[model samples]
Target chain A: MFSELNSILNTSPENCPQGEFTLVSDRKADASFLIHHFLSFYLRAGCKVCFLGLVQSFSHYSAVSQRLGVSLTQAREKGQLVFLEGLKGALGVLLEEEPSPGTHMLGFLRSPRSDLRELFEFVRASSTVLLSLGVRVGAVVDFAHYCRAFVCSKLQGNMVMLIRGEDEEEEECDEEGAEWLLRALTHQCSLALRVQGLPTGYCRDIHGQMEVFWRGHGSSVTGPQTQQKLFQYKVHDKGVSFFARGTSSAVL
Target chain B: MLLDIMQTNEVGGLVIIQDTVDCCGRQLLKGFIHCALKRDEVVHVLGFEVCENEFRGGLDSKFTQGLYFHDGYTDPLGWTECPPLTVHHFTPQDINTCLSQSEQLKTVTLVVDSLSWILRHHSPAIVCQRLQELRRGGALRSVLLLLHSDMHQQGIVGSLCHLATAVILVAPGMSGQHTVAKTTRRTKSGRVTREEECFSVSEDLTITIEAQSSCSGKTLPEPEEYEADPAANLTFNLRLSEVEREAKEKLSLPFVFSQEKKSALLHPRPGAGRILYEPDDNDDFDQEDPDDDLDV
Candidate 1:
């Protein structure tokens, strides 16, 4: 249902789109549950994923992957699997640029943009803006500036931006983000600009009309939605590559 | 050690304030997290509450999000009121419904902060089955259950240890607590090495590990330099030949090696059917003391 976002600290989006993550007293019994369900979804979906904050070598993913015949090395080289350190580097690269404008594979998500350029020039003319977690307060204020011209899309997506803590303001992601973007769409709201964050899920209605999101610091969000946040990498953990960039190409 | 793995990004580390945030276990968790932030790439702290459930004499969280993060500071002693980077909350029922709804949901890592309460809701088997479901999804990330060390021996917990990809056993050693991460799922054919480590949870959420003074003046790699990933593969074979040496040196117990493990420890026999029957010699002495004092 989504790109795998497995992490010791995060829930892999590949296995569960609207998944539930819990921190129990002991993870031993539950380790397999996470791996199986997540891999079932991720392998079928063909998403590039990562895992972060897990302990030891052959800890979780490696143990299972060795059993399943997946290669951590192949995944890493092919851009499918990743670790926390790799995730950090990816984040660094993405945040380094402003999101590129044009037709995108994951929409603007896979689309690369740099911070070195002057932004907000295109967002003012856009109707909806999808942002990343790394996008700071920049896109919000920019979207607010165009709030009258075009209704802004809610900030939520895979590989997204969020506060590092647990208490983010609650919003119905399925209903609100999609509905608001569509409402803005019907009115032909123009100039939607998002902060620069490459969230993990698909944009239900915010794509065609210049969707905007962010990739900067903010309050952490929790509840089941917290699980939806990116884990370091999903496919990366399994040591397999070959994820689906195109919406229809995710192969099991 | 637990502190090393806890600091690494491959694991989810937690500290629970039992009877107010200062249980010895909580101290262990705090100390480890404080040190982890300084050494790892990215460390996240999921801060949840444990308010008393007056009716049930239990605990629950104040907000929906059960997670919070405290980024490492230049110094662990400093504190701040700044909002956390992430927070997520949910009801129990919603949690179960999610897995069933997904077509092929892959839930790789499920790090439980405390097994005590979750176990309170269901059995270790129930948690185990859920984990089995997650493993059916795809490639697993890793699973870490952050519970007090005492739970290490419970059958319910032992079963979890049996199912764990890696079991990180931490106990207060002669010089604080030493962690031994053993992979229950791994069958490594290499030399196993054991080393001592120090722990402290900084004011920030990172867990710090310092080499014990015994190994001082020796140059060692930083926590990350220990290996590509020492924590996940970090194992001390409990069933290995070296266990006796650890018991003598680290555990300080009379570990008599025998053909079978059952004969090692003296514990109460299994329950008969659904009943528990045992007599403690300490209770018999205490019972006579009260009567003797009463001149009965």
Candidate 2:
């Protein structure tokens, strides 16, 4: 499904196992390119895609997909694409003031259920419906940090959960919290990748660095020893390009 | 200065000024507001970190008339020192409400000087969604200038950068003479473009791009050739030149070598021709008696 990204991860589509969950931990760089490219890979591979955008708007999401050469309208018309606007309702639940009466009929959040299992199940059920349509299903979830790892463990298909780390100061104080979350999510995923934006002064074009921690569960590739693969990346017109630092040749 | 890299006229866009904790983000923000005001754009500032007086202390008196300052930092009971032209004080919880109200009335720009504070109080997801709403919403024909510190809430910063139309990262350089400014913009064609330059903040609070800070034309240091004509390594010496060496010898203390001190060792050395007799000592003489009767 993913031509260049596969090699960057050291795994091809033919060897890619099903039901693998990959977590992309982004610090400073824009993760939209990675998420969009991941979705585009599946869409190009004829997989039915469902994007559960909790933090991003459908217009911005679809615009990015369209720019990546994925026809969002055509894919939707063919029952191959679906967008789940989860943020609006989620925000309503998270609001401090209670939703007043008569707002329930207007489809506002009226329930006081504090558990995120409902949200997780809602997204999972949507992906299952797509899976039952006799095609591969790929789901990209934004703001999955709000969902519990155990709840995310129940998801199906090729799932990718994008989590943003804390700021530099908070990260220093409550690093255990961030690391605990990373450990929890990494335990649930097959492949764990971290993309960090390098401090902006050192290089000209390269904006950030990405490292693959490991691939578990259903992959033929063994994890690296002593060191994992590292590549510097820059955002471009097509998408993002990954290159080995100090070398002009592209890694993917 | 800051707006030179951006489109100042386009309505419904978000501009983020990402400055380090030590850099002058507020000054750059002041510059942006003045630029917007010069274009006859009505500017509303939601201040959470700095008070109105402190915020306007660096700004010109004429530019302050066109600006509407919303103070989120000061409590309602706080005393003011300056005669307010257009300053409003609201409780912290009512910041979003105040923002929405001002956004509806403002004509040009909505500047939030403390997005980090807002993100702390609200969900990052909701904050980003609201910022996007303010960017595209028709209630306001305004652009957003979000001033954020580079030290805190980096995850939220990434999300904000993704949502923003333009992101200006300002960091103080090593020498402190200029600041490194990295601007990443999302073009109308949906392409992400990045530009890096150095800028110096002047005494007048204006930012000027340094002309000699292009990092593209820099060349790598040449590697040393090790195989061609290798030379022998030289030894390090502490001695001075010949004259100094002669002077040192003249001033040196006399070496009084003791002539063959034979008693220096624990046992005097036996002469080669001398014969020594061996003493016969019983092993029991050196050993203490097992039963000395001391226990009794």
Candidate 3:
């Protein structure tokens, strides 16, 4: 499904480099497809994957991964996948008289200051356990900074994060932190993928556009020679197709 | 012009490079690094955003000789046992200590890969105050700060810009080949210079300044240009020609009454006063009194 994207990236799941941080951002478009692609790709690579399902539930991801030829339930039973459902955990922390041990990772939710140190420690402990199992680890999380240092430096693993781009019209106080976090992560990430909808509004043929920025200074197969590239993509039930911007079917 | 400013012995106290997500200012920051190294100044980089390797990437090996990096990226919160620099309690004093590590600190260029990170972790007022301390202490030659303008609110960006001696706004140029930098520099003599230039950074960390599109000192529109008639673009004529002016002066408007007519109209003969009334078909005039029906 991601053959075209792999070709453009010049690296597949098998040969993908470790200790690399990839940031996926979207503006006026949903980039959850890219997240699903990376999640399944890394899992198929036989790496221990820690899925921090913040924006969606485990069933949603499991359903999507099933369509992509991967069994998340089976991966979990085999100890290759660790799924942390943030929504469920948050509710458990809020309503449950006694939160379960597994939900302790979300203890930061009950804190007055909402400090993420507890959550960071939780991720660290999990990653350590995964590392002890003698497998490369790949973490899919929204909070990159909490696990970035440990995941990339200590474990020598890869981290892929998805953050929604800020809308210029909305200036909410909560969004300020998100915006700063996005910029800070972009500076640190080796690769950045941005998905944006058509500025001209909805189109029938072309869903949206994506830009890949190879900002990594690493000496890998795909070096920073190709700084950036743009492509138009259409998402399908089972797969997504990416083509050069002007080469979309409608444009032709 | 940007290169010229960097090459000079005395750059401003605080130089802020404002860039958006589309047009990154990292290349420009590296350009400043190269210029600082070329001038034989001690360069200390506080990298909170990227690792040392990534920061040093694409830079010439020779340029790295005099460059010192304070590791704020790795173990920023000191989650690990030991980190070279911990951002948990970052302050100007900590930076001063970092600067004092190197000998020959006569002329030092402190490059904050980004001040936005510091601003996020710290209050804007405190950050500005620390920057002022760093500037006023005379410990460093100059401070080069990289800021993501879109990431911060306009008020915060404005305050930071107010603190900086020079601000360079980098935007994507019309052509993708280069980026345009609009620089506004305030000199010590109270003279402000603004210029827009196109610049492209090569792979080897070399910056080539292209054509200068405009500069306040050189390309400013003259006073006469501002004084030019604004009616030039109007479809109708606003000014009359010499012959037309003479004809307009000779012509008399019908609405203007002479002194004699004015006095005559104001005084008016007593007997000449009369009322003229005309009733339309729709108008019903009751000339007869309704009281005639009553016994009055």
Candidate 4:
């Protein structure tokens, strides 16, 4: 006996909601179902899990995880196990970039292999919705800020990019210059997202800024479209981004 | 950048990394501890998936202690309900910059969460250069006992190994009936060294299967392109010497040109691009042959 499904589904608020809720399936492929299930549960739990895997098809797991969010442990204990596909609904974030329209492209470390630590602030803020929003009183984000933060927080998902304005190279790089250009995107994670390169699509240098493009496709209805400016960064911590979370899910 | 040394001068200390320590400082400590330890040691850690709520809960004398930690990216909630650990939460830049930047410890025992993306994002050359520079600055006293995981897609780790005082590679050893293989080859001598020692990290992030023994000259890291830089100024320094030689050669040219011709020319005649350093008497300057006549 669920209270409502599409009621709040369509009007989903911008804030990350923490509650105990069940996820329903909408006839997606096997992978989509599993992904949706777990994603819904985590979203309600107020935990941001950066679901990473192959960049395509992650539904079966999503759906199953969503359906059994609460009783999954019990289900397994009673010999009632629901096995789902692993590879569906798997595209974590899309990549698209073209060129930036400014005369600025600075290398992070050096030309050929530039260092990228300079852009960590922007990336960190963009990764978590709560990180981008106003201060939290308890766990509640300001509703208004929540909307903008939700949109801005996902620069990698929905933002389109146009790197390299005119065919000019050689740009000056100062901390201030790159910071100004590497601001947050407005809307995040949508279908028809555009990016040109790896990670962030654009880089600003002494010459100018270049734009890359990518498209983000949420659960098919295609979330709002956006284009994150060429906000790029390269962190120097070689082992920082990855940590073995201990044989996650035991190979599922 | 000056804090990576250990009191002992050996290679690598047992580095215990968790969200409670500074990534940068602990990294240096890794090198420092390795360099300082006279005997093999064990490093411990607890955080994230293992002890999220109790990340820094067990630093008491009762529980095992890790050298230090830098909270890179901890679980959003932190180790459950615990007030943020007393440890500092430095930005990625701080940790990254100092890994090689700090020379406090060499021969460090480094234990990190993962090594894949970190290797790709930050080239190991930069890390080594930072370490080398620190070493030159007398920041570290000994070799480093590095403790790290081989993130599946690590880049230039082989090259990084070259600058290491000694390398200790740990990974999944083997499955039932199958032998797990992770080998390091020395670049100078193309010898293939098999590793009899093995290491395993338990689910609790504790160190296991450590068979630390002193073995010399097992392997050399490949002298790949990533191995080229350490002095950071090698290119500039070499280029300057080359330019100086060329300038001297140009000034000592055998040309009998007018004073104005020599005065006006900034470099060798348009086509000459070589930096010939030797002062050969047979430079053909004095040859009577028409083909050998010096021309500006």
The numbered model that scores best in TM-score is 3
Cα miss at B59, model 3 (Å)?
2.5
Chain A superposition TM-score per model: 0.26, 0.71, 0.85, 0.18
- Cα lDDT tens digits, model 1, B35-83, are 3323322222322211111111111132212222322111111112342
TM-score of each: 0.25, 0.37, 0.79, 0.30
Per-residue lDDT of model 4, residues B6-103, tens digit only: 33334322222111100111222223333223333333221212122222322222323323443332322222244332112222333334444334
lDDT of 3: 0.74
Off by over 4 Å in 1: A1-252, B1-4, B7-23, B26-109, B149-153, B173-196, B212-296
Candidate 3 wrongly placed segments (more than 4 Å): A27-29, A125-143, A165-188, A197-205, A216-228, A246-252, B78-83, B216-296
The TM-score, computed over Cα atoms with residue i paired to residue i, of candidate 1 is 0.25
- Native-to-model Cα distance after best TM-score fit, residue A83 in candidate 3, in Å: 1.8
Clashing pairs in 2: A167-B154
Give the DockQ (C-alpha) for candidate 1. 0.01
Candidate 1, overall lDDT?
0.32
Runs of candidate 4 exceeding 4 Å displacement = A1-30, A39-252, B1-66, B74-124, B141-155, B175-194, B198-296
What tens digits encode model 4's per-residue C-alpha lDDT throughout A1-252? 011221222223243322111111111111132233334433444343333222232343343444544443343344333222112211111111332321012112123332222222222333222111111111111121222222333332111111111122214322122111221111111211121223223322211121222222131111111222342112111110111222222222
What's the CA error at residue B82 for candidate 1, in Å?
30
Q: Per-residue alpha-carbon lDDT of model 3 for A1-252, expressed as tens digits?
A: 266677887878779677777888888889988888888887887878887776788999899999999999999999888887777887888786587777887776676554566656766754421211101112122235547667776677787778776555355434334455566567667788888898888888889999998774453322222368888999988888899878987778
lDDT of 2 by residue, B1-296 (tens): 24454435566667888754235455567667766666666677876554455466655566666687875544221222442211233233344454454434546567787565565445778877676666555545555555544434557678778877778877656563656677777767776666677766454556566743454333333467335533445475554899988897777354643444434543556663556756466423323574553457
Top model number, DockQ: 3
